[model samples]
Target: MTNHWAHPTAIIDEGASIGEGTKVWHFSHISPKTIIGEQCSLGQNVYVASNVTIGNSVKIQNNVSVYEGVILEDFVFCGPSMVFTNVRTPRSAFPRNTSEDYRPTVVKRGASIGANATVVCGVTIGEWAFVAAGAVVNRDVPAYSLVAGVPAKGMGWVCECGSTLTFRDQKSVCHDCDREYERNQDIVRKTKDV
Candidate 1:
């Protein structure tokens, strides 16, 4: 509460909940009903819409707009200019109010969304997942997966340390952390016997 910082140019609407040590930089707009946790950083020109929930230690870079129905878990990194869509198919003239029309986007704990990436709605990005720059994610991303390309396909698995997995005979090891992961049908799960 006392440690939070909001620039003079930032507009935090009434009823917005910001946690201690959080910082809102210039030209940022935090909408009413938005809940942001401690140690979070909202960079310049950022817009967090009402009903969005941003968890502790989340770093949202400049020029990003987090629309309603997006939930960012603890330690999540939203890179500069990344996009999150709430409605799967949106039309300005034809508005849909049903709950099914506005799908929620969940960014799991420790996930990192790279700069300029686009996350389509209704997809659950798993814990520690990495989305590469400029990728368009249209489906659920598994935990520890490194996804890239348009419409984002799982190219490989990544460690919790954010290093790529080196595969040998259906098993992969993390070079940085020396952790082991088992690959199964495009999903990688951590193994205990590393």
Candidate 2:
């Protein structure tokens, strides 16, 4: 018996490893050699390329395509229509189709990517970081930071519970969840979790 659930229209290829309790919704296609963790949700029309690794409890919304070389850690949220690219440059005359030509993009644990956001290849989106809608991310995003706009820039800091954090003396306490964080220059880390 199958532990996970896939819609009748969804296609899970052989050699794809999907954990128990995960759900693949309508018209979604999971390619071979992809590993999707437990309790994850793949929404409608989602396409997962080969060799991609998605951690537990990840939520991938509709119309998102997870290309090769993309690594989504546990609890990551991929908003609807969010884009992930593996190639740096493309031309009709020249094709870079192999895995060696693809650049790796890592979305750390608890990160949330907003709708219509485009994450370019070779970037690391940090843990608990929030990418606002329509942002074009080309660089590494720091942990617990909020980024927005085209070629996304750091707008503010956020708590692990997804609340905006107000830093005073490089430290802040989350008003919503009461989580505590400290910042050293550009780096932010959770000091207390309540």
Q: What is candidate 1's lDDT per residue for 76-142, written digit by digit as tens?
A: 9999999999998799899966645789999999999999999999999998899999999999999
Q: List per-candidate RMSD values in Å.
A: 2.1, 0.5
| Model 2 alpha-carbon drift over 4 Å, by segment | none
Per residue, candidate 2 scores C-alpha lDDT tens digits across 30-127 of 99999999999999999999999999999999999999999999999999999999999977799999999999999999999999999999999999
lDDT of all predictions, in order shown?
A: 0.91, 0.97
| Clash pairs for candidate 1 | none
lDDT computed for candidate 2 = 0.97
User: What are the TM-scores, per candidate, against the unseen true structure?
Assistant: 0.91, 0.99
- Kindly give the stretch of ten consecutive residues in candidate 2 with the minimal lDDT sum: 90-99
Q: How does residue 94 of candidate 2 score in lDDT?
A: 100
Count of backbone collisions in candidate 2: 0
